[model samples]
Target: MYFGASASALQRLVEQLKLEAAVERIKVSQAAAELQQYCMQKACKDALLVGEPRSCALF
Candidate 1:
């Protein structure tokens, strides 16, 4: 009975870790997307400032 309880606890811990990792991955993905958007906007604005053509493919 003790061994069974230990196994159950270990399984729960593993599942919790997996959930935490998934959450972290989602957060990182969102941050990356936001950063990409900011970069694209900055690039387009810089191009306009320098009198370059506003042909940004990201937009």
Candidate 2:
């Protein structure tokens, strides 16, 4: 029936949306991790330049 076909199409759309959402989440997580790494590296470089051994010890 037409109703059954409509329901199937709706289900497919929902699944595609879910997949896209998951991909977005992964991308966001990766970006956040990269940002954290950059921040840590910058902090370490700064500490080293200032000769602050104690500050760099946290890494």
Candidate 3:
């Protein structure tokens, strides 16, 4: 019974890792798109207002 529970826990861990990896990939893709947009636009003060804290703005 103990062995079975250990195996089941391992399986759950593996599945969670797979899901985390997929989430990471999605975030990277979104960041790439945001960066591309930031680059294509001007870096004027108006653009700086786009993202937040002002300084964190990409454009």
Output the number of the lDDT-best candidate: 1
For model 3 the local lDDT of residue 37 reads 89
Cα RMSD to the true fold for all candidates: 10.0, 10.1, 8.4
lDDT of 2 by residue, 1-59 (tens): 44657877988988998998887445878999999899887885675556874643457
Give the Å error, residue 46, model 3: 23
- In model 2, the clashing pairs are none
- Candidate 3: the clashing residue pairs are none
By summed lDDT, the worst window of 10 consecutive residues in model 1 runs over: 45-54
Cα shift from native, residue 58, model 2 (Å): 56
Which segments of candidate 1 are over 4 A away from where they belong?
1-5, 25-59
Off by over 4 Å in 2: 1-5, 25-59
Whole-model lDDT, model 1: 0.78
